[model samples]
Target: MQIQLEFPAALATVLGMRGLLIDGGGTLRETFRRIADEYPKLGLHLFDESGGLREHVLCFWNGTNTRWLPSLDVAMTEGDELVIMQAASGG
Candidate 1:
């Protein structure tokens, strides 16, 4: 499966800028792992020691945020767009 990855900001060096077209498969976690491999610097900005999402980023599959999903176990379909955005902060 192919997923469209959109980066919201100037993130880690591996992410470069703009978007990325990546292979998608299995679970959402798997997709993240693939991205991490493609962009090594994203690992620290997104994953924890337990291998889960870090506290500062939110991911959306299609138009739905994964936080509302059954779990991060969501799978990808061909041509699905995966948007990775930096968490909004500041009060």
Candidate 2:
């Protein structure tokens, strides 16, 4: 399915764009894998050395935190939105 992807300003600054449309898989994992394959630089910021989401990274599926969801394997359909941002923590 085709989905819309939104990146945080910081990440977009680095990538030079804020959002795009891409063909994604049924599951989030596969979508992320396709993203990593298509944009390794952006993937570096999203995934850690172990290929897992970094501690500070947050993923939202249609405004709901993926962490709160039952699984990242949740099926996605066309027009779904995936938002990525880094958790903010500072004084």
Candidate 3:
């Protein structure tokens, strides 16, 4: 399967592109693990020391927040889209 991943500009600087087409078929967690393997720097920004997604990092899986999903083990399909962003903060 080929999944589409979109990143914010700041993260894109690390990825060298705002969007990426990843080839593989697996659960969401596995796919992210693959990305981390390929881009360690970007992984730092996306995952915490425990390998879980950082609190401030928001990932939308096909427009629905991945956090809202039942599990990160949700299977990914061809053409699935994932949009990653940093949650806004401060007043």
> How large is the C-alpha RMSD of every model relative to the true structure?
2.0, 1.4, 1.3
Sliding window of 10 residues with minimal summed lDDT for model 2:
66-75
lDDT of 2: 0.85
User: Each model's TM-score, in the order given?
Assistant: 0.81, 0.89, 0.90
In candidate 3, which residue pairs clash?
Answer: none
Clashing pairs in 2: none
lDDT of each: 0.77, 0.85, 0.88
Model 3 — which ten-residue stretch has the worst lDDT? 15-24
Q: List where candidate 2 sits over 4 angstroms from the true fold.
A: none
Clashes per prediction?
0, 0, 0
Off by over 4 Å in 3: none
Q: 74, model 2: CA deviation in Å?
A: 1.0
In Å, residue 21's CA in model 3 sits off its true spot by: 0.8
What's the best-to-worst order under TM-score?
3, 2, 1
Q: After superposition, how far is residue 51 of candidate 2 from its true place, in Å?
A: 1.5
In candidate 3, what are the lDDT values of residues 2-51, reduced to their tens digit?
A: 98988999877886889888874899999889878887988888999888
